[model samples]
Target: MLRPDDRGVLYGEGVFETVWIRDGVARLRDAHLARMARSAALLEITLPDPAPLVDEAEARWRADGEGALRLVCTAGPAGGEPVLYATVTPVPEAVIAQRADGVRVVTAEAGVSRERPGWSLTTAKTLSYAANLAARRSAGDRDMLWVSTEGYALESPTAGLVWLSDGVLHGVAGDGVLPSVTVAHLLSEAGGVHGEATVADLDRSDGIWLVSALRGLAEVIELDGRGRARSPWTGRLSRIVSRRPG
Candidate 1:
């Protein structure tokens, strides 16, 4: 149980990692942990040793089962020790469906300036997610693509954005967007470029995808009511990222 004064509970001061578990093993475990550590450091929260929690997650996973594992570290009650915990749960069916079928997206103003000073936490996976969740809720049936006040495409509420233009892969980059582990892995396997994007650029792309740990890659069939032609590269790229690391 959490204390009333815990900073995470009282002020949303925390960091977390959501790992995709496949066949009882956490996929990209090291990457997730490294990101979490970075997030913790940004918040000045000392992360506890993760080995015990990782072992516990491994023990809970069934031989051939799949799940989502969450590891959380939070600022403890006032000046107390930082709190840490882990949980494993089934991956939502909707996430799996989106991975196979694809998703529709709508771009919206993020309401925050990407160039704002002292906002280094923008790229961290911190627990202050109310704004992100609200953006998704506002999008309703379609997922939301957060854009800067200047019309530059940033990223989605939960996933990173990647697109194919003239047969080359590209991703949204800079301090404004969260550095996506899934996108990095995909791009490392299949060469890609990283730079700023605009709605017009996305509209003219050969294909667009929302990349994440849980969703893998969801092709964008439609964007802002405009239909996009399916790219032949989707299947080939998906196969590349789906391969388990040796």
Candidate 2:
């Protein structure tokens, strides 16, 4: 039970991880836990042993067949042990549709620069997502691609950006963006580069995708009202990412 006085309820002091489950197994479970642990450390929340939590999530997966498992850790009532829990739910149909049909995206100013201080929380997957949700609402249907105040492409409200140019796969990299496990896995399998990108760079790229845990990869078919030719690599890359890793 969550108390009103808990720091997570009162001030969003928490971290979370959403894992994609298939065939009674959680995909990238170790990577997700590692990232969650790092985020909890950054927030000064003591993380509980995740073995029991993983067992709970696995039980849900065994029951549901396919779904998303969300594990959360919150700073429980100040001066007390942190609250940890996990929940499982079906993956949204819309997210699945986006993977098949792709998505149209709009670029928006993020109002922040890429140069963040060492203490910045931008890289942490915390519970404070009001700003990101607000930006998505303002996009009004299409997904919003957040660009830094310096005009460099950062990421989407809920996903990471990856593009291909001259047969080279590239991922967005900077202090302002959250590290994406999905993107990292894809890059490791496909081989890629990590660097800063501008809107113009993406505009001319061979392909673009918004990668996430639940959604996997959604191609960007249109951007700011301009339509792009579907890339031949989309199908091949999708197959690469869909394979179950050992």
Q: Highest lDDT, which number?
A: 2
Q: List where candidate 2 sits over 4 angstroms from the true fold.
A: 62-64
Residue-by-residue lDDT tens digits, candidate 1, 89-202: 888999989877889999998877768677468878988999989989999989999889988888999999999888889988755677899888888788898877789999
In angstroms, the error of model 1 at 93 is 0.6
The whole-model lDDT of each prediction reads: 0.86, 0.88
Question: After superposition, which runs of candidate 1 have C-alpha atoms over 4 Å from their true positions?
Answer: none
lDDT of 2 by residue, 1-246 (tens): 899899999999999999888777788888988999999999989999776877777775665456888898899998888999988888899988888899999999998899998889999999998999999899998999999999999999899999999898889874678899988888888998787789999998999999998888899999999999999988877876677786
TM-score list, all predictions: 0.96, 0.97
lDDT of 2 at 68: 87
